[model samples]
Structures are given as structure tokens and as C-alpha cells.
Target: MPGNADTLTTIAALKSVSKRYGSVTAVDRLTLEIRRGEILALLGPNGAGKTTSVNLLLGLAGPTDGKAELFGRAPRDVAARRRIGAMLQGAQLGGHARVHEMLALYSGYYLDPLPRMETLRIAGLEGLENRPVVKLSGGQKQRLLFALAICGNPELLFLDEPSAGLDVESRRGLWAAIRRLKEQGRSIVLTTHYLEEADALADRIVVIHCGRVIAQGTPAEIKNTVAQRHIRCVTGLSAVQVKMLPGVTAVNSDGERLDIVATRPEHVLFEMLRLDPALQDLEVTGAKLEEAFLALTDDNREAQAA
Candidate 1:
């Protein structure tokens, strides 16, 4: 479980923050807090205002109403800004510069920057220091961006889809680096479309839809919101019979193997065992993060339509 938001030290916060572009509202009076030493994942589909929320916190855009703060001061304050680092999506450095040169330049911006070799190693770019930015692969470039973000030694880090275009191996490597940063007591705010990334990395997830937060909690808590479970077993029971069982929502069968989806697993399992005492290899699992995400977003759409 994540620490209570009320009791944790808030490194950044949005208080009734609303960002509007004339008639369109990008963020609709949304409030969120990023606490120390936790990875808070901001999840939403395209146009859900995840980017807008991050921009508000980074002071790239002013809110139409309410406030954004960092270290209890206005986000744009120089002293407050120094404590934060960000790797925003679609941002890039000069493609012609060598990796080490770019890092050295960024380091010069901070009074006490991380050593060049240390930044390179942390980003998994140790051997590629002399390579030009344009020559690096997609994953390497992304790692470079990450290195630049942490070079300032900021306490709070914001990563927006940090692994958007990486291959599976690259993505896993990035996850390792993020975990290392977390172990070092640096707080991170991650925004990603990858439900698996959020589920695997975040201490808590904040789901947004149509510019407003629709759900927020630990991974298990969020998954539990949908109230569904999956049960698998090798049994003689037919799919038709399983569907007829109490609390069973859906059922499928592959020869002797039965797959059941239900709102009440215990009730369904009891009824199944009562009918098939020989059932074996029973496996029960809760709703996946992907299912919960789709369900929550779909529910929000229906509510808006109503």
C-alpha cells in the first residue's frame, strides 16, 4: 500500500488546477499530489489531459484557474524549479552533438550536477559516450534523455512515456534504471499508455478521463474496482453448465479445461465443485489492470452519454 497522501511530504501538488484553451478544457479542476519516494503513475488514453497535468506542474503552461506548486512554492519559482527534473514526450536535443558533449552542456546548467561518467552509467550509456546523438538508436536516445533529467540531481522526476518507442529488452532496462532511482529515494511521476508498465512500476496509479481523475489507488485496489475474477480449471463441467452457475458472468471451455469469469469467484467455485468434485488444477486470479482500465473508461463514457 502507498503511504497516506495526507501524511506524506508532498513534493508537488495541483490544487483545483484547471487549464482551458478557450472553449476546450484540458484539465478540469483536477487535483493531485506527488509524494516523496514513490512512483505515481498518471494513466489515461489520448486526450485525457495527462500531458496537460504534467505541463501545469512543470510550469510550462499556466492554469486558467487554481494553482500548481513545487516544494510549497509556485511552480515557476527558480528555487522550486531547481528541485525538479522532467523528461517530456517528443522533446529532443540537437541531433548533431556527441552524447558526452550534450550531457556536459546540461550539467553546466546546474550548480552541482552529476558526474558525466555517473550519468552515463546510470542511463546505461557508458560505452556510447562518444557517439553522436543522431547515430544513437531509439532506446539509447531515450536513455540519454533520462540521464539529462537526473544530471541535475533533482529530488522529483517526471517521466512522460519514457519508454514509448523502445523494444521489450530496452523497456525492461529502463524499468531497472527507474527502480534504481526509486531505491535512491527520488520521487517519480510517470505518465504512460502501457498498463503493464503502470502495474509493474507504480506505487499508486491515478487514472484520468476527459480531464478529470476517475480513479486513484494502488494497483490491486484499482483492479478490485471492477469486481471481476478469472478462474481456470481442468474439469468435466461444460461451458453451458458453468454459465448457469450463480455469480458467473462468462465461461469458456477447451476440451477438459474450463475458463470462467465471474463477479463472485467463491460462489462460482463452490457451485462448480458441488457439481464436479473431480475438478483439478484450479487457478483463480483477480481482474487485470487492462480490464480495469477499459471498464473504468467505458463507464465514464456511459455516464457522460447519460
Candidate 2:
């Protein structure tokens, strides 16, 4: 299959890939590609096939149909696998091993791994190198996994919720390290539930739901697809009355505040104020990536139901 014109090189690709287990279809005819020097975020809710897709790409699970490739070669090929590094969810190292020892062990797998000190620094484990894996905190352990993934100095990296157990500070630190990796021209495939992480780091995002991709685009592009404005204010207007207004799709009330989702905020606001002249603290904001995600996924569910 040909690569996308926007990308300079195709590092990995899934061509009409599908994976199934008996009656369950984990991934359904999913076609995706990872480009060189780009961070592509795969996002979806639980049971949405995100992990299945990643497994297919990494050759941990074979596709029931179609193909998965790395560097234009089969993902299972040793050479192809060597070019890729992964930090899968729930992955763990030997509990008795020291952090540095584990990193050294993983480094030996590749012909040219990153320097041990560099990997330790990037993973925020410089001083903790002597600490045993079991002694590390959840956040520290996550950082070590991240360090191990890059230890091989791979051209492509796969991080499945790398910051899952990290605190705010640790998450930011990991983000910085990822940014540095990107600067060094490593392509990355990131599966994360954090929409903000995708918005902040991904060059492109693929949203899958019910084993199929519902949307794929840059963050702004995906958000623009919904084109809804959020209006919130303290108003006496009832949720039912607000929902009946022109261009209003949904409305929710929390105590004294009314939240309105509208395709045309100006029209909705006009109606809202007419009904409740005492409305105060009016705020209108464009649709966030989270809102767009919900709208797109909900639309797909509705379509499938129909």
C-alpha cells in the first residue's frame, strides 16, 4: 500500500487489518499508518480495540485478516522488530533487578542502544538507578518502563498509556522526554485515554470505537467537525426549554447553572436570554476535543443502532 502524501516515510502500517477471537471482533478492517518523525495517538474508550490494534502492529497478536508491517517488512521480522520499541500497558520487569541492570539487559538486545546514563536521565531514574524494580513507586516504575522502551535507540516507539500511573509532575516530565524523542526524529504510536495528552503531543489522532475507526485527523480538524459551541450561565431557564431552542442539541442543569450544547450559540443565546433575562455569568466556548470525541462516538453508535 502507498504511504500518505503528507508523510515523508511510512514507518509502520496496518492494511485492512482485522483481529477476532471466536465471536468477538477486536479490530475490524482497521487501516492505519505511522509516519516517520511523527507522534500518532490512538484513542478510544474501553473495549474500543485500541490495545488490540497496538498488539497487531507489534506482532504480539496476528491479524485474522489483512497485514501488519513495520518499515515495509513483516512486523515479526527480527530486523523490523529491532527498529521498534514498546512500553505496553501492564508490562513489568524483573522485580528483583536494579533499575540500571534492567535497562542494561534491554539495551543488549539492540546493536546500538542509547547510553545507559542517557536512558536513565531521560526516564528520570538517574539517582534511582540502584533502586530495585520492586522498590520503585508506581510513577517511578512507569518511568522505568518508558526508559526501557527507548533503551534500544529505536526508530519507532510504541507507548500504551505510558503515563497511566504518573502524578502531574511525573506526567509532565515524561511528556518532556517524549518531546525530546520526537525532536530526535523517532516516530511514536501512543495509545492514551487522556485527550489532553493527544491534543498536546500528537501530530494526528485516530479515534476508534466498536472495533472501527470513527474519526482520524489533527486535533483541531476533529474538533472542528463537531462545530458546536458550549454555553454556560446561571439562568432560570429550564433544561427542557433550553433544549427546544434553535440549534440547541443538548442541555444539562447543575444547581443554578445551565450548560447548553448548541450548533449555533448566537441563536441559542438569543433564545436563552429572552426566556431568562436575569441570566448571568454567560460564557460561550468552542467545542473542545473531548466534546468532539463524544459527539463523534455517539453519532457512530446512533448510526449503527439505526
Candidate 3:
């Protein structure tokens, strides 16, 4: 496919890729592409072949069928690999090296690397240059890993669970950093378990289930896949009573509070008000990303109409 203003150039792609280990198939004919400057969030449940797909894309493992390309070349190509950076899970970053020393050491690997000072600044680790890696907190160490990943001045980055162990503040701070990288025209493949993180940062979300793409779209588009709405309120209505409302799918009650899931929220709310005029704390909202995710992967839910 040709690149246009609206459809950006593809820097990396997995075309009908399938990875099999023994008789078990990890990725089943997965077709994915990474645009030049967009953040593509890869989401899936455990054992969903997310790791295997990433491994194929990064050339850590080869596909049993189809192809994995990096910069239009085989993913393992030396020149192509030079343009990529990755901060994968279970990486061992230890010993007594200081933050600055670590950055300097990683910078030497690439032919063209960002200066150690610049890498530190971009990673929000300027003043902590002298701190030992072992002494850093969970969040600080994560930032250090990010710095190492970017010091190579790579065009593409694979960040797997970048904020896994972070507190709320630290996670948001990392979010800002990721946004900054995107603004710099870096393509990032983010594999994260945090749905909200993907909702907040992804230019597009690709949800995988059973080694295949179950859904892929912009956040709004992905949310629209499910027709359900959420209604929560403190009312005098019982679960049995709310369940009787039109379009209501599920109802949960705790004392005077109730949570309702429905396909037609407007219809349900109208009936709710008529039945319980004293209802307070009433809030009706569209489906959350989490809700859509659950509904999309739900085995009990009928097979996707598409």
C-alpha cells in the first residue's frame, strides 16, 4: 500500500504472520502494521500471543508463516535493527552502575546516539545522574530503562509495560514522556495490560484474542464496537425491578445503590425515572474501554457479527 497524508508510511509490518511452537500455534495469521509516527497499543489477555507476536516483529523469533518486516526489510536485518529500540519485560538492569554511566554505555551501541545529557533530560533523569541503579526506586529505574531505550536515537520503540510498577503520579509522568516521544515523530509499539493507558495514548488499538485480531480501531471506534451503556444510581429500585426495564441486560444492587448495564440507555433511564422519582446520584455514561474489551472477548456473547 502507498502512503498518503492521511495514511502514514509503514515502518514495520507483520503480514499474515503465524508463529508456532511445536504443535501449539501462538500467532494465527496475524496481520499488523506500524506507522511511522503513531503509537499502536497491542492489548490482549494472558496467553493471547501478544508476546509471541512482538517477538516475531522484533526478530527475536521467526514466524512459521508469512513475513515480519522492519523498515521494509527483514526484521533481523542489521541495518533495520539499528533503527529500533526496545524496553521489553523481564530485562535485567542491575549492578552498581550510576544512571549516567548506564546511559553512556548504551549510547555506544548505536552508530548515531543522542548525547548522554540529552537522553537523561528527555527521560526526566537529569539530577539523578549520580544515583546508583540499584538504589533507585521502582519508578526511577523504569525511567532509566526508557532512557537506555531512546539513547540510540531510534525511529521505533517497543515498550512493554512501561509503567507496570509505578504509582499514579509516576505513571502519569511516564505518559507525558511517551506523548513527548510521539510528538517527536517516533513510532511506538506499546504492549500494556492497562486499558486506560492504551485509551489515553494510542493512536490506534489492536486487540488480540486467541492469537487473532478481535478488534482494531481508534479508541472511540473500538468503544463503539459494543452497544452497552452503564447506568449507576442511588435509588429505591431493587435489582429485580431494574432488570424488568426495557433494554436492560444486567443489574446489580447494593442497598439503595444500583448498577445497570443496558443496550438502550435512554430507554432504561426514562423507565428508571418514572418508576423511582426519588432517584439521586444518578449517572448514565457510555461504555468504558474495559467494558468494551470484556464484551468483545466474551465467549458467551454471540460471535461477532462481522
Candidate 4:
């Protein structure tokens, strides 16, 4: 598959891009690319420069140094961005305008827009088109923003926290719509706070911290980076006894329950059964994306603080 490199023919590229305000650097020499027909997740903590990176791609802000490109052209070039669709963090819709009117207004801006009815159908707002925009719920408004973004049949989509403020059902609906877009071969760049969202939708995940790319890989690849297995078991062994097991790294307890954090889960469990002889419930799961995310970001923060 094509990557974020020049030779790889990515749809979007940031070459050593940086945005600085006096002594503060919002984005620091960042370089990444979103390839054609792939969903790439931009993962980061608060103040991790995720929004700054999106703005650079949208040409909403000029970089202090380096370049932001879309299909080998500058981001600000209207012709280059003609195939792009962008939905920023916060969108404002007219209070009194009907949903259909809002769709019509945005559709007019595009050179070749989808039919208003088709747009509403695609956004799952067919019956609600006559309703006022302000009367729509937060999730509905988000769906409307997504509808407008794709009205032009854009080849590239930029979604910043696209599922924010959406309920579980609305979120699932939006996810299905995104999958349909992907099936049509549209490339997507998504920024989401929900780790599961990224895990489910993104073909590749890129984690940024301290304004730089810290980790980049597939969901499984990122999760495996931690190389730690978590084991939850109901055993009669005490905390101190569990700690003495070979390869058991850390162990804690909550009175009647023992919580063991270890590098070798199998060895810990083996020892527990042999010693206690009455281990009841047991379950093993892989390291969560959130755990790896926190660890990766914390490492970057520590390095910066050092």
C-alpha cells in the first residue's frame, strides 16, 4: 500500500512542517502523509497539536516553516483542494434555516454537487429535511455537516473528531456511512478521541505528542508494541504470594481480591493454580489501545520535561 512518502504517491503530505508562535511551537517539524483509499487516524492527547496539523492540511493556517501539500500541490490551491472535503471541529449552521435549505446552500458552492434529496438520504435525514437546523439534535447536526462535506463527491475527506457529540446509535450510523464512502474508494483522514473508533475504522493509526509523530502503525501493530498481556483471575492466593511467582512483575490487592500486573501472565497463572489449588474464574485479554496510547504519550511528555 502507498504511504505518506513522496515516492509512495500519498493523497496528502506534510514535509517537515512546523508552526511556531514566538518561543512556543504548536507543531514541530511534523511530516506525515495520508495515502489514497485509506483511513488514517490522528491520535493525540489534549494540546498534542492534532488540530494544528488538520488546519495545516486544510490551509486554514500557514506553517512557520516547511510545506503542506495535497496531491503534490499546495493546500491553499483551489484546484488542488477541489477533490477535498473538510469538516472541522465546530460547525455553525443557521438557526432559522431548514435542513434542506442548508444542504442546498452548501451544495451551490460545489462545482458538481449531489442532489439535495440524495444528500439527505445519504445523511439519513430524509424525513427531517423540512425541519429547522436549530431544532436538530447535536448528532443530527453532525450528520448534516458530514452530508455537506461529501455533497461535492470529494475524493478526499478530512474529519476532525467526526463522531463527537453523537449518541451510540448516531455514531454507529455515521460509521456505516464512512464505510460506504471507503468502499467507494475515497481516502479519509480522521481525528477521533475514541480509541475504539480508530481501532474499528482506521487502516493506520498515527500518534502525535509534543507536536511530533511518536508512533505510526496499524491498530494491532500499535497494541502489540506494549508486548504485555493482562490476566484477570479469581484465585485464593494472597497478594504477597502472587508477587513471589516467577515472572510476576507487579501485584496489588483490594482486600478479598488480588490484582496482578505482570509481564508473564501464563507463568503467574500457573503458579497461582499450583499454590492455591482452587483458582476459580480466569480471563486473558490483550493490552488495550488506551494503555499503549497513554504509555506512548507519557514517554514523550517525560522526554520533553527532561
Please, what is the whole-model Cα lDDT of each candidate in the order they appear? 0.87, 0.87, 0.85, 0.81
lDDT of 1 by residue, 1-306 (tens): 235563288889999999999999999999999988899999888789999999999999899999999999988998887788889898765578899899998887777888888888888999998999999887788899999999888789999889988899988888998988888788999998767788889999998888999889997776666567889999988898889888776788877788898878998899889999999999999866566567778777888889
Give me the overall lDDT of model 1. 0.87
Pitting candidate 2 against candidate 3, the one with the higher lDDT is 2
Using alpha carbons, what is the TM-score of model 4? 0.84
Window of ten residues with lowest summed lDDT in model 3: 1-10
lDDT of 4 at 105: 82
Residue-level lDDT for 113 in candidate 2: 98
User: How do these models rank on lDDT, best leading?
Assistant: 2, 1, 3, 4
Tens digit of per-residue lDDT, candidate 4, span 1-306: 244343245889889999997898999999999888888998877678888999999999899999999877889998877789888898866598998888888787778877888778778888998999889887788888998888878888999989888889888888998888887778889987566888889999888887899888998776555345566777777777778877655666666566666556777778787887888767676666566567667666777789
| Models, CA RMSD each | 3.8, 3.5, 3.5, 3.7
Question: Tens digits of per-residue lDDT for model 2 on 164-213?
Answer: 87888988998999988988878899988767888789989898888898
- The parts of candidate 2 lying over 4 Å away from their true place are 1-6, 226-230, 234-241, 244-247, 253-257, 263-267, 270-292, 304-306
Better of 1 and 4 by TM-score: 4
Q: Report the number of clashing residue pairs per model.
A: 0, 0, 0, 0
- Regarding lDDT, does 1 or 3 come out ahead? 1
